[model samples]
Target: MDASTVPGILDQAHRRTTAGLLMLVTFIAFEAMAVGTAMPTAVAELDGLAWYGWPFSAFLVASVVGMVVGGDAGDRRGPRVALPWGVAAFAAGLLVAGLAGGMAVFVAGRALQGLGAGVMVVLLYVIAGQAYDSSLRPRLFGAISAAWVLPALVGPVLAGLVTTHASWRLVFLGLLPLIVLGALLVLSAGRSLTAPDSPPPPARGRRWWAVLAGLGIAALQYAGQRLDLPAVPVAVVGAAALVAGLRPLLPRGTARVARGLPAVVASRGLLAGAFFGMDALIPLLLTSVHGYSPTAAGLPLTAGAVGWALASQLQGRFARVPRERLLRLGFVLLAVGLAATVLAAVPALGGWPAYLTWAVAGLGMGFGMPSVGVLLLEQSPEHRRGADSAALQIADVTLSALSIGLAGVLVAAATQGLLGLPAAVAASIAVCTALALLGARLAGRAAAPPRAAVPGAGTTLAAS
Candidate 1:
């Protein structure tokens, strides 16, 4: 169904469900942005540079496991059981990470935290898919997207200040209450939801063991970058691990250039990696070359956030159109943004361009990210929702690590060595742009014709 035909927000009937879902989404984004900002300081204090990747890695790996468990539990037992469990796990992780001391100890704490956060995140996706009717889905998601705007602006800087002054540990410890509150918000909606359990799922996809392998290999990839590990070994190990992990999780034809649900999932990873990999470099660039404070480096991302929010609202209007076309458009914008940032290498235009370029990338990203999200939800089976959601996150982080890790090499070569910082960043941006454009084409191929229209897909926008 065409999204343009849906009812706008004020005209809609279901206000409570939308409120709960949006609240959940906003909280998640808030937590994620806050954590990203604070971690650098936390790492410095703990002197855990060697294991720095683990904190984020822990969340991601555990989230993969949680996706499967939560999806299964939601499908068989219902989101009621899954959602609360998710919140509990995420909070537990936060509490532990906050209290941890020393690098090794902190890494352990992060691992536990990630496991719980993973499950909770999947449950949230299932909740979003299940609770809101079709017509409301897009706008609800858009609002969630909008919620991220300010957080991007403020989250990093605040995290920087907190780490620099009060306590980095406070960031995690503080989030504990918010996690509990978010869980309660969902729980309060009704009698706790519960789906009937079914027979056990077969191990044909990226199930229990495979998830560990995927994450392990991803960790190794990060290790490669951190320690100057050789590329051959890193690629060999990472490839082997990913192949093992993807054996069951992805739909057929996913690894190759292609179309369909599986392809959509894979493309999401590429796009995510391209953006995140490049994004990781942005702060480093601002701090090192631009001579901006950490908080100042974060400001450019805020512009991206603004662009991200504005573009999200327009997606429902484009929903009925071909998915690939939209995907391609998003990539084009990203490439353009990257191109602008690349110009930072040139001395005459360096200063202001640093801040302005990302706005373009942000806008392009805003257009593309939600489209993929709606597609993932649309394709998920009630039973597979958890797995799909988990897969989506896993793909995002895994690729992000690859992109970011690789950027370290390029940026270092350009800045640390002889090529020069601006030139190095330009090279880095160029690589990301190339990958993003390629991913855009893949998204195009993957964009299949929608199935028969839903009764209310048109009405989804009625509330806008």
Candidate 2:
């Protein structure tokens, strides 16, 4: 049946899949949101002041490799084969990190979690492509985005409270049981999914490239932590490796922001880089510069998340409003929010402004992020959905890492007395704001010709 005649996502036919998917996303979202709040305390306790960014960088680097392998597996044997392994790896990583006493072991566990998250998240797109119709896809993505809401509202605060009163270890250890439950639900719901009839293209080359990309990011992260001249050579090498690695992994013309799928892919990177680059630093900015407690530091994140969820729901409800317009608006808001957030760095302005500024940025992401997913799926050929999904995610992770690393370098400069903390933070926000504006400029390129409408679902948006 076409989407118009199909049951709604929460209806009997789709209830299990929808529930399973949302449940899984929620758990992941909680972990992601909570990590930022707990990280400072965790690093301090472990006595790893210089290694602050390594945990996050390790996760992002490992995720690239995971996405490559997971995409191949999903294409070959479907989500059934890929999903379980991803869950296993993620669980193992959490266990390791939770039990660790040192920074090295903690980072190692985070790497494993990144690998598992990479695999499972790619399969989510694969599953959506396989099981849902075009019309349903928008709603699915919207719901997926909304899954972050509850986590956003409470995850950071809860993490902060737990880290303060209890052990930070509980933050990692707490999620293990929930992970198993989500996996069981998704696996059971996905039992009917199967691989394509034809063999997929060879993934060997892509896998190798992904590894190279991971190494490159790791090098860059290392360079970011170092303030001396020795970091220059490492940064150059890392840049070269990253460029080489991304050439084959992303869509053709992605670097140049070519129209259609290439632009869509590029947009994801830019948007992610702009948003997450600032996100990872906000808590640090507040606690270090403004003297906010962990719980207080997490409030702005909650505000952003709330904005994201609300905007996603509205976009989903008004699915026919033209996704490109929403994307453009999203970028504008993100740019504005990011730029305004710089005010928080100035002691005269105070830290309260972050809540509002970040909320605006979150609204932008709420609109932009899901629209990108829907557009990609709409443009992707059925057989190549896994590969394309991998590309989209690769862009998100790669750009986010680069942006975060850039901010890390600035933070290092501050630590080493080369610049003031406020200046470093402002500089990082400025860069991210520019990226959001770039995304706005390229948003139209992601559009396609409108498709024929379903009876009451309304016309699909396309480039005029």
Candidate 3:
């Protein structure tokens, strides 16, 4: 490639697009972080502490459906048509959520936000795939990962301050204008892009499957929150629903981890499941066992995010290294980090070890996550980019929900005297570490052989 033709992410032609994409990701990250911090206060003010979990569950369920719809729309009409509408929906949801008077209204608003976010995020990946060279993709993903850093560090704290002094509503409402600005920037840059000449073969029954999958995820989340025998039945039903719905939505052979694209998709699930499961539990372990304050406990999470950002930046510089190799290295690092983290549960060691150990794990995620995105793009054809991106995200969200649910079950068991708190923590870490190890073992399968490459501007997967 000629030097003049090789456009960097921040070069004049791509600079506005990159900025807009990062801005959108940053706003989403901020909202995600801020909601957890603000939720208790919001629920209390609404006099609906009982319905606290519904807001989150609603979002998760709706997002799955949105992803399917968005992917289909992107493929048929292009991201230009879908992206602005997604932003508008997200902004409207924010408005509704900010002005909500009841728990029902709040949950409804959250569902809207989830749907919009789901659509917007998938379309973002499609835009990246369409607009940039494959060589530039790693850096684009690195920038997206880095965009989470500021939000991870300060979003919760800012939300807390807002909720304490002003109102929790501001947490939702404050980003409206910024979201609009990002949409406008992307819209301007998007003018140069084009849609497919004709829509790909229609995906029969995929939308319905997406809805079923969403409900399944919500049921699982609800079951995780419940602490009684009734939870068992709910969990079983959820699992059945998830299994049925997920098969149609994902690539063929994904469940069995077939080589190439299927394995790449499966790897995402394993990576997310392991990372997020531990991410959700570590703070609880520190606060409950080590007696650390919430702020002190959260420092480790911030450290992890920082490590993730640093590692992502480093990986983006080494594009020649096979992505599958980087992915394996990441999983190994994550497994080691998780294993070391178990020591934090030991009374003799204290929680200080977590700050360092989790940072190592974060480094693993930094490398692994972006590689997954890049690999997915490399394997998918232009027409299928949106659908394939949606599949990758589905795997991530599904596995994350399941892993967290499993951890929750163990925690509930500890509360019921079935095990000690330390035992529960140890068990959860063990499961997540095993998942990371599994990811490492299967990482090689994620790569397509050189001969399998399709000759086109976009890469296509070979069915191995």
Candidate 4:
């Protein structure tokens, strides 16, 4: 389509592309929400209760590798190549998982799925940067966020139904065709687009560093889950490995939160870490403390998803607002929401009040997450987009893993009677709250003047 005739995301010309992207996102969202529901049954049937957490850990670690490799490939060859491969791998993973007779095989399948998911996420962002102009990006992201709403609301229920009537295997088997359908849509959209000229291949050394980083992240996740072991030494080794590997993978000065793009990247991690840390705990608090059923406990999560969609729509509608301002507002809301969730630890406020509090946290995520995405695109040069996108994902995933790991340790301690449940919950939420406030502080640094650009990179934004 000509520039003048380029239609909106919902217009006829863009309809197929939009539908395909949304459908892909919907399937991913459904799997993410549904897996937790089916896991209990899967473990029971396989007699793999001892290995319950390995599936999740394996997926997460393998995803880090996928992101790194996908980003490099996208920068060198284009997202067109990366996207289809990711979809194929994801589908294969589903088949493997569905057919598995044992836990080890199931974990391997999950790792493959995670790898594919990581690749897809980076490619999707690259696709968004390439296919849509800046004017259309916010709406596209908003739509992506909206796609999660339905899955969040019904995915678990649907998984439970399938498990009860047919088998949990259907949960994996059923998604294979949908993956093919989504891949077809993406490939069709890709046909009309021209690939950007490839940049010089990255140094072989950088690729090695990426592999090391992925391994480190995996080690850290494994260590976190194994807190029952000698905690101090395991944690120390994990931390050292994570830092050593992470140093070479990110932009220079990211560890120090250097102003501009580095700080923006750091802010994404902080926001994700704090938000997801709290999210992981909310259901536990409801079911264990408040005596709610599993389905009933999930209602707050549904409410949170609604709040997220609503906020995303508002940000998309008011695209004129400065992204940094929205980010700051989002962080403030997150901090407040986290603080409010601590009320559930209080005996008098344990039930319904917690739901509203968690919804506010979700609203913050809706605002902050998309704004970070927009800023990443705006800040990155065409050649660096893939690497920058990968960095963003790495930061988000690693920090979230660390945050949840720490919280798990605290919860385990409480369960063993080393601390009161109320105290454990309070302490965990407090740490997350502090991180949210820190993110708000970092948002200002992110808005500062960009550092000197590398040769062939995009022009830096001038400080207003």
Candidate 5:
């Protein structure tokens, strides 16, 4: 049985703390799903299709900066200090996005929003790791997964409705109340946070991290946006910038996606890329080909919500589950889900099959994401918690940016017909998903932990 099921695995204080933190999840989901749905309209009306990938890409690239900032902030000020700043920054980004009239301004808003989301997400993970006992972690992770189900169900539809009937501007504007509410809840738990056993970060050199992180994400995202520039050259440059960014943060082997820590980080990137890449493609395909209206097309997203929720519930229920098994399960579901999605492009079953596949892929991710968190926390040093957490996001956002950018390229090239977009999307995702499965398997089979990275690009992150 899970510890949470026991009479007192959580004290009153812990329950309050859990309640407070969960609010963050709820708002994050709302923001994520709504932004996604509203984006199609935002770009179409704003005449930002030329930069359609920017808002998402910018957020992802900026998230790298947020990770560095959040890690440094968490190490020095604690999650309490770092988290609110993240929330406030994110809210400000939304405001910027809501008001932007042009693509450049919109991109800037996304960059800032990315920074905020990255910081808040990692800090929240840190808080969850620190606040709960080991035995209770599964339930916590499960709940985190469960949180997505609702927003998945409601968020896209709401965003679609808002976009069709009201205003896409409201998509950003509407998030204000929930964001405010969630932050207040976390703030209320301020007194209960325990101290990290590690000393705070060395104060003098910390500011440079912000610049490094920003540059790193910008370069990596640019590489993703421009991948067809000869695969070797693109990989060479992309690899270089990615390594440069990692120099200070992760362990050495991680950059190569090596045996230990590198593999963990790589797995995170691969899976996230696979999921987000598909997500970036879906609305485009549905609206362009199936004659579905924006609101109607968003139903595929809801399928993901269902898959994520059900799978998360199972992750928690199955207590003896190994980290390896969790990891493997994640890849399998993802591969299967993608396969289902790929089937959509096959032209035999028509459209509904594609929707089914997308949902399955989402469920795969819900099972996988929290499991990765469990692995990272189990291995992280308390002092390095912030850095490790940030690295995970860095991997996710970095890969996601690349994947989405590539998807965009495919859509542009394949614009000859309606079928072209889905075909390109499916093909690109298939490559990433297959690669992700291999990475996951290697991670599960490895006996030793990942080694710590020296401070340099290609610096490998140590497996905990």
Candidate 6:
């Protein structure tokens, strides 16, 4: 390619492609935020109180499977094949859920949606890796983070309005057409994008390992949610399954957080687990302890999103900063923010502190998440990018599910009078804080070794 022909993300050469990718992310973000707001009403109307958790759990578990499949397909073929199918599945799921008359049907639809979302996300990473040059990635990722800001601010409100004035089903149904448009944009761009032909065969039997890994993650999440029952035995079995299934799917040394790529991936899981766990609990804390209304309790979430977008912009602007340093700083901020949020459990502190504290945690996420994405691209070879992206996302979703489940158990115990509400909240906060701190420690190891080769770029993987 001629130097003059190389185009930036915003240039005419790439504008349509960038718009399409951003639109996809925006819609997904809206669905996630909107569904959370509408879920209580949806469940109540369906009279599915007993199965209230399954909608989310099913989506998360199915996503793991989608990630593995997408990774394999993208590596074997290309995003062109995987992406369109994912979009179709996602749209189908939306229609199913929107039209469903029962919670069981709704949960199944959510599982399908999760599968589609998982595949789409992994493919997006692959697309970004291939579509943009190294110089453009930070800006591209920043733009993607910016796409979340609008949804975070308005999705809940819009969903609430639609649910109250119209129907909860509209929330799901309304997104279908927009998703179709996004898919078209992606497919059009994919036609013009150049990608390597099918690579050498993948490791023999890897797909089976991927399947087992997905099942293990789902089983572990199920067991975590069932902690109220035979806690020890269920947890033990879940752990065993998770280990056996996860070991082969991840890069070597991921369990021990080896230097470079493995540590980067491990840090992503720890950061997401700690951050999202605390995020899920915030509204509960505000409503239960501070006596705020649902709408009012969600204000902090909006503020957090603002902080996240701002930090993401800052990180992109200062692209020369070492990604490892940014990740470390982000984790430290998250730990401090979570630690401060625990203080909100005190009656004397009042609810206002959360608006500020949680924003700090969001800022941390803003810094760390994009940095991790950049580092992953830096470390990965062309052929392995899809698989590595899958591993990164798997860690994120699995750890987040586990964290939320544990928090639920603690909250449940508190409701049952086994522990005080304050104690339960504090304990959950402590666990998340510890994870953040541990991630901070590991951030240093996330840096790629000096002179590491970019795979398929005609360089050897020799460390300086």
Measured by lDDT, the strongest candidate is 3
| Sort order, TM-score high to low | 3, 4, 6, 2, 1, 5
Model 4: colliding residue pairs: none
RMSD of 4: 3.1
Residue 9 of candidate 1: its Cα lDDT? Answer: 43
Name model 5 segments beyond 4 Å from true.
1-11, 39-54, 99-108, 203-239, 256-260, 286-297, 416-423, 445-464
Cand. 3 Cα-lDDT: 0.88
Which has the higher lDDT value, candidate number 4 or candidate number 5? 4
What lDDT score belongs to each candidate, Candidate 1 first? Answer: 0.67, 0.85, 0.88, 0.80, 0.70, 0.81
Query: Could you list the CA RMSD of all candidates, in the order they appear?
Result: 5.7, 4.9, 2.4, 3.1, 4.5, 3.5
On lDDT, the stronger of 1 and 3 is: 3
How far residue 356's Cα lies from its native spot in candidate 5, in Å, is: 3.4
Please write out the lDDT profile of model 1 over residues 271-355, one tens digit for every residue.
Answer: 7777777777777776777677866777777777788788788775665676567777888888788777876556565456757
Off by over 4 Å in 3: 1-4, 201-204, 450-464
Q: lDDT score, residue 5, model 3? A: 86
Better of 1 and 2 by lDDT: 2
Top candidate by TM-score: 3
Ranking by lDDT: 3, 2, 6, 4, 5, 1
Reference-based lDDT, residue 200, model 5: 62
The CA root-mean-square deviation of candidate 5, after full C-alpha superposition on the true structure, stands at 4.5
lDDT value for model 6:
0.81
Give per-residue lDDT, candidate 3, residue 262: 83
lDDT of 6 at 36: 85
Candidate 4 lDDT at 53 equals 82
Tens-place lDDT per residue, model 2, 1-464, is 67768767887777778888888788877888889789999899889878888898788788888888888888888887778899899899999989989999999999999899888888899889887777787788989999967787888778989999998999999999988888787777766778888847666888889888888888887898788899999999998898888877787767887667777878999989999999989989999999999779978988898899888887777678777788898999999999999989998777889989999999999999999998888777656677778888998887888899999999998998999999999999999999999999889988863444222111111111
